[model samples]
Target: MIRRAMVLAAGRGTRLAPLTDTTPKPLLPVAGRPLLEHILEFLHAGGIREVVINLHHLGHAIEERLGDGRRFGLRIQYSWEDPILDTGGGIKRAEPLLGGEPFVVVNGDSLLELHLEDVVAFHRARGALATMVVRPDPEAARYGLIELDAEDRVRRVVGLPPGVEGTFRGFMFPGLHVFEPDIFGWMEPDAAYSVIRTTYVKLLAAGMSVYGFLTPARWVNIDTPRALAAADLTLRTAPFRF
Candidate 1:
């Protein structure tokens, strides 16, 4: 079972600026609780006992609030990034802390209502190297879409995959994934790059088992102030499912 997870919390949250000027975006309040706290609570219920949260841009606030994570029933560890290492680099740096097994990775600012165990089970059953949690975004332009073949294998991500038939499938990546430790072999250590552009896209082109597990529930990406406000209102009404 995948009991370890990583939260990509190193971002500066420039999109949600000013408020993030004093607090890390993940630490921002959602329904009276910090977003990260809600995520941790969900992770705990999902059977994840250990978690790694990468920090930067007012990282101290997160460190101070979460502490060693005993209060949250988690063994929390921090990966401090001096000059915020983008998604790929952040995960690469935290490789040691994540151990040598497959693990879950979620964006700290995301609020997803889905079954984590099911996602892990799907990953194991398919023997997939990496699996992303995606949702149908018919307007594919803004978020870029990931297309899957009949076998549910990702045939294309944004652009076309090598030697594929006519038009490929497409869907939006919603900031959640199950990744095997071997997936890190595709990333560059200590360099800033996007996991999507650098790894997923490349792996798909090379015919790897990089697949997408579609979610039937709504996902909240708390990026802008308006988005955060909407998420806060939503969370107040509907309880998280994970």
Candidate 2:
């Protein structure tokens, strides 16, 4: 029953700077369309009718392009960030629009063909306060990692851990999640925070039910110029179009 969603687009794309100097990362074109547009289309196709996108850097251009989401058949709203709150803060700012239930959060920059319907069902079935979409890979060190227990529940976030064996639990977060409204109880409204550095790890330590949905397919997370180029080629051959 997760009909509402939030797309985190408020980040100052410092990594993709220069280009991001003029255009916001979410509005950066991929395959001739803004990356956020593809994300919205994916949500629309997955039965999500309402979406709120938080914008910070060069946010106005994005608002102008996707205004009210009419062109895409979605009821879009903007959570304009003046001071540019980080992930948790941005989500908290949009909580009113997200309503009283669990909603999907998709990173505006990453490109992934996720099964939104299935992920929503999984989140509800597990009753997790939050559910993260992860992929198994040896490159977990390059990107932050997630460790899943025997039951597929997230046991720990593996970046800079004290000690760990082989890359057996090699999983990287894909920047997408399903979150219940009450999860905000763990956040501080006045402070900015990252879900990865603060919330997800905090959830794991508190024994909160945080789970990971390991996709059995290939996924792409575009960040650098080279990564973006590769994602464009991959999306061209992807079996399913989001």
Give the winner by TM-score: 1
lDDT of 1 by residue, 2-72 (tens): 88999999999999889999999999999999999989987887889999999988999999999999999
TM-score of each: 0.95, 0.92
Candidate 1, clashing residue pairs? 146-171, 147-169
* lDDT tens digits, residue span 74-117, model 2: 99999988788899888888877886877999899885676688
Model 1: lowest-lDDT 10 consecutive positions = 160-169
Which parts of model 2 are misplaced by more than 4 Å? 159-168, 237-240
Which residues of candidate 1, in runs, are more than 4 Å off?
A: 160-165
Candidate that scores best on lDDT: 1
